[model samples]
Target chain A: MRRLSPPPTSKLVIFVVIAFFLLWWVPFSHVLPEGFPLRFGTYRTFQGSMIAMWAIVALGLNILTGYNGQISLGHSAFVAIGGYTAAILMVDYGWPFWTTIIIGGLIAGGIGFLIGVPALRLTGPYLAIATLGLALATPQILKKYDGLTHGTQGINVRPEVPASPDFIEDWFGIKLSNDEWIYFLALFIALLMLVLALNIVRSRVGRAFVAIRDSEIAAQAMGISVPRYKIIAFGISAFYGGIAGGTYAQVVGYVSPESFNFLLSINFLTTIVVGGLASILGSVLGATGLIVVPELPGIVSFIPGAGLPDELSWAFYGAALILVMIFAPYGLAGLFHRLVRVGPARVAGVLTPVQGAWLSWRERRRAPPASPGQTGAGSEDRSSGDQPGTE
Target chain B: MEEFWQQVVTGIATGSVYGLLALAIVLIYRSTSVLNFAQGEMAMLTTFVAWSILQWGEYWVMFPLVLVIAAGMGAFIERVIIRPVEGAPVLNIIIVTLGMFAILNNVATWRWGGIPKGFPAPPEIEVTGIRFMGEGALDIGPTVVSYHDLTILVFAVAIMVALYVFFQYTPLGLAMRATAQNPVASRLMGIRVGRMLTVGWALSATVGAVAGLLIAPLILLQPPMMMGVLLFAFAAAVLGGLDSPVGAVVGGLIIGVSENLVGTYTPKEWLGPDMKLTVTLLIIVVVLLIRPTGIFGRRAMRRV
Candidate 1:
């Protein structure tokens, strides 16, 4: 019998090394002609940046909904707050772009903490309803505070232009445009966020979050302050939303109440669901879906006899969500994980006849008499158990 | 004082519409335990049906026919789309409804252009002002009520009374209540729980259609016109309690009055005209904080 062991950690190390090389070299140096149309590098950079922004938000949402088992429908409100705050700071207060970005995040996180104080007492639909109200109200509030937010007219932002005298003639060796710079900045933030999120998921705090998500009562009995943890999750999630909003504002170069509508919140949540709720990589996938899918209807309009209205994009998303819930409940990330696990296990011949027999006997022993009530209870319990680490 | 009274009357008229929509929402919630986000869009579609009917006949004559069609469409939707997800997770159900929201909105837009369409008012009520305090000429006198406003108030009250009678006295209503309380028990009692649920949807659609028709004359009919009304309806539903029909009506009146009063009296610098949505949201948040189940809702006990 040939025994199979897990692949060595060195394999991961090598993969990362090669991945980084490709990420850096392929876009800028190796993969393109001198004058490629539309500049694939710039496009990739922007795409990467947008993905990073979404990943950050997804990580935050994961901590709250996935890790803490709290449902919030007002996340886009936080994003709007963050974006508007950054814009105001940069335009009105004469704050540097970076400073405004950080401040925006902190402000949003603080507001999240306040909201969470009241929200922690509520659960399920009650929480969801409260957040829904918030999402609906934020745009109105923005409109009311027109002096601050510029109301329906919206605020326009100028990209940060590098001030270098030596390279003024040759653009100071800055090959990348302002849009490219913003993209790279967003990407860097995303990478940092990804690393932090991964580390947190592996840490004690992450474990506590998972425990709480699995069973708040159980976690509480085991000495976790469930309310405190829930608030922390809210704060963390808001923090990510804030940064993402700021990044979005910078990239779009415009901020409006319409930009952060309740629809955006739904879209973000859908992204997380479609990308796989628990997986970090799923966030990236979800972001990609969010950005790319909306463009499909528009792109298809160019084809003869294939024109679709812009609103069809939303319908497509709705259909996609339904299909995903019905068939791929675990999402793309879950599917990948299952494939990874099952493929290796099957390849390694892990399941022998004796093992199969043992497993079948175990399954039989575990199976309870099937009833509608029992099935409902069983699924509920399974969901409850799976709630932790969902983000 | 005159302006205040005018605002109050206007608020009440608007509140009646919100209350009607809220009642529809409550009916659905009570029967299904699902918040129908597409309620406004559904109502809009049904109202459009009513409008199409009006194109061929008189307004009052078309009303009943529109209601029947709306009810049938509602029941059809419940059977086709909502029934399958009865056993799904709450989030999944929510997503489906959101999908419906998108689909219905787009469908309406596709059918009817984005331009607002005028809805003809019934000839029985005109826009003439009625003297409340003998045509008061005082500097600080109450505002005169318009005949149109009175008509709306009367119609709203009549609908509520009819609904109360139907729910309190009818067999179908009892079946619906039973299904809402416990579907399994209702099924065991041979109550046709699925049919009751479908009826609930049908009734809700009918009520929502009426609401849309009432409001259509005041604000021209458009694809997105229902969005703001839906928000107010949500606030009313939450305020009254998600499950109680009476609560929805009362909550709508309160929200309507308070919104108007606030708009009239609030400091110009603090809250502008747009603050109505913000205020409604604040009320919802505050109410949830104080009582998550709502004013009239009984606390639900979850089995672990």
Candidate 2:
């Protein structure tokens, strides 16, 4: 059971460091001989930036919704605020890009804290409605302040060419396009946030959040200030959203209320759930799904006649969602944990009775006439709660 | 004064649409503590079905056909997508609904395209000699009313009364309320809890479908048509008291009328037309601060 947990942090860090070096060689995949199906493309960079950007936002939301036990259908408003703040500063004040991002995040965090003060008393459905209203109104409010947001015309930034471009050209003798710049910068920020999130989740503050989520009354009895922690959680989460939004504005080189709609908020929440609630690694997996799920048909187009019809993707996507929820309530992270933990348990005789009963049940299903008595006993055992699913 | 009276009448008529949609929301919430974020999209899909039926022939036939189809669709959605997440964490249940929202919106777009098609409404109200909204000397009365507006008001009331009777009088409705109150107790009493939930979804869907049919003609049919209507309805439900059916209706009427009056009376310089959505947010936040359970909702007591 001890070994079943993810590998030690130091070892995992070493592995990631090695993988980081390996990533440098990926861009050269295009030089492969003709007829080789695999290749690297600029689209991959854009997709990579999207994944990193989404991961950042999803992680933020996971803290508020997952850890803190609040529902927000309007984090997009925070994202918009962060984005517009950075965009306005850049377009109007000519501030350094990095400085503007920090300020943008601060503003968003402040607003989130303010919203949290009132939100502390509301329950699930009511909180969700408030956030939903925020998502709907953010765009209109942005438009209303035409003097600042440019009123739907949107504000665009001049292309940014970071120091990494020069370093890439000097070291690898390759040009760093704008997409790659955004991707690497986003990657750096996402990694930083992931580490910060991982630290926070395992810390004392993180434990307080989980306590409140599990049972607010119990948490209060344990001397936790539920409202204070809840507000702090909201602020921290908004800070994450704001940073992600600032980078997003840079990635697209434009900022508009249209960019952060309710759909974006939903997708952010979806990724966090599909990835795994209460897990940092789950945020990454969920972000990947958010980018890939809609494009599944195009990704699988290589197989003959396997592409989903354009009109039917939603039906299939919906069906997939229902199936995943039924079968994988813990999402990708839960499945991975089970595979690791259960695989060893089976090998080490930890689940011998259950395994034996399952194998015998399978054997009986294959040949019913000869195996009635054995299967009946197995069913009796299952009824008494030795099945793997009973837990 | 005529303009003010005219706006008041317009408010109630328009508010009726919000009332009906709010009832749909309350039905599901009462049965299951879960909020179905996909309610509007579900209604929109069925309305599109009605639009297709209209292609076959006649106007009135689409209403009955849509109601039947929407009931089944609602039940199917509950069993397929919603039921599996039952008793799971609240967050998981919400995620399922959000997924449903995405799937429904995308499917509707694929089928209906993004275009807003002009839907011919039931009938125009023939006006005799009354010009009220424009200006000057005139009488502020229901005599200036349109047939469509009359139908909206009538339909909203009739459905509310019918629903009230169903819940208060019928055994099935009582069982549903029981299931909502306590599933274990309901099961002990020989009520089929799962079937009751499916029925609840079906009934809620039917109500939403009616609202959809009524609104589609007003907005012209489109995939995203019900979004604004859904928002207002949500406000109505919350304001009237989320757990109270009567509260939802009253909340809806208040929201509808106030939303109009504020826009009509206030200066555009202070609160623009876009402020309507903002007003909704303000109402939701302020209401929760003052009375978290809403006007008609009973306060929930929690035990440690």
Candidate 3:
């Protein structure tokens, strides 16, 4: 089987340059025609930055969970660590913005490395349970150390104003507000991190991670240092989570234990799962799903008396997750792949009734006959067995 | 010394609740390698069902009825939701349970509102002072043991004995154990493995409901009240070994004692009340580091 080669490095370079230009100029008030209803200036910029932050976190999680197959329920703990570190540095030490962000990532990465050393020994549910404990414990620890974290009261952080006048006006087409400057900074960091993640995934370390995910024992047998790789994945993930946390703190201008609860962890997991697990583009999709799906009820509430109770959204989200797991196990990324594969054929009118019937028959014929005593009625086995490239 | 004894008794009582939930977790893990993260929420939901039933029925009538309803609910959930993902990756199963956690918690909140509800204690059992260790120097210790502690201890012990007999002596228990150990072989021997798995879930839910009911009086019942308990229960389950029932009980006791002791010694400003969860997590980490199999759990030989 021939592996699909990634698009050329020159193409990626061109893409990055174009992306940077668009991110900077496309969100400006002067760029859009007057009275363009779809023209969202600052809001688009802010949302784009938030999406970028989530993409970074998802990419980090992809390394640990998607690549290494090690489940972590405590990724948010690292995020909290990053947020708190940045908050403390800015508030207490008066550290420079860029310096604090770097320090935040370092602190989170160090913590991740230490945790991974002990935690990587376990696998599957044990790892999850351990991480879940860590997630629960972090907020408490933060609250307990009130002198440092400010307890539940949290620490307020003022955003750093950009020093460059040309850069600021070019981006926003006006004198940049503190929030706008922070947003652009976050957007730049997110884009840089995303490119870095893409490069890493294409590198040898990424292949080792995939190998580890596919089979730990086999990876080890093939001379892959499982524990070391696992730790590296955790460290890298923490770094991204840390950046995301720092960015979020900068945007919100507040850091609290309540902000980094177990629900956030679950939401993050939901984002990754719904977005497309291992796929890079899927991370963005997942983050969108996380943000958008929760707001669906709020959107619905706009209709005259048609809105569901706010609590119903949680249940709906839960049900949506279950349905996705059951029906679309490969997630929206997989759905996109399937659509891409079938789109041309469908458009060409090749899927006629006779052709469809023949295809169905062939599919049935190709499927291995069920064994005796196999009560294979559920759709789960079908989805699992149909998963690409497994068998 | 008296305070120490009082803490020990309190620990045992709290440990009993953890043990009950842990036992349920182990049972589900035994049959289906899925750790039910929703166990606490499910239990809490069922206890609410029992609470609703008690509005009309007598206390005695509602107690047994609630257990039955919980068992049925457990079995139904296993059949409807968990059965589909029985053979998927461990992570997928975990996510499924988490989904269930969200659903059940939301459902409870929707029905009961987010406010805390008081758990009613039976009038007969409301006697304040029934000294267990005599009333002299023992009562003058760090924390005095209450009548509630003795009642909880006795109730926990009774449940344990009943469970022991149910699993060891009953044919259904033997069949369930056989299925858990080797599902294919059990199926080949003409046992209904799927049904047994469902039964396991039912039994687990019943035990979870019992734990919920037992603890509700001590802690006010709320939609998210059981979340904390679930963490401790998960720690207890891991500490006792994921596959062993007896291990869950012992693990719970160890966790309960350690949490109390740590809470007592740690400065009020440090971990404080939240130390219970942190201490439990620390114990779990330590246990996994030293002996992944857990105390009283048989070492599993993994094929490389």
Per-candidate total of colliding backbone pairs: 2, 0, 3
Distance from true location, Cα of A81 in model 3, Å: 1.9
List lDDT for all candidates, in order.
0.73, 0.77, 0.75
Q: Give the per-residue lDDT digits (tens) of candidate 2, residues B1-304.
A: 7677777777887788888899999999998887777889988999898888889867777778889999999899889778878987666776787678778888899978999987756543335863212112223354366656667777888888999899999999889999999999999999999999999999999999988888777788888898788888988888888888788888888888887777777668747566866775687678877888788988887765
lDDT, ranked from best to worst: 2, 3, 1
- Which ranges of candidate 2 are over 4 A from the true structure? A1-37, A160-165, A168-175, A343-391, B120-143
Tell me, by DockQ, which candidate is best.
Answer: 3
Candidate 2's error at A32, in angstroms?
Answer: 7.4
| Residue A261 alpha-carbon offset, candidate 1, angstroms | 3.4
**CA error at residue B220 for candidate 3, angstroms:** 1.4
Model 1 reaches what TM-score against the true structure?
Answer: 0.82
Over the stretch B56-118, how does candidate 3's per-residue lDDT look in tens digits?
Answer: 988678889998999999999989998887776665677788889989999999998888888
Candidate 3 clashing pairs?
B3-B141, B3-B142, B3-B143
Q: What is the C-alpha RMSD of each candidate to the true structure, in Å?
A: 6.8, 6.3, 5.5
lDDT of 3 at A121: 69
Q: For model 1, what is the alpha-carbon lDDT of residue B209?
A: 89
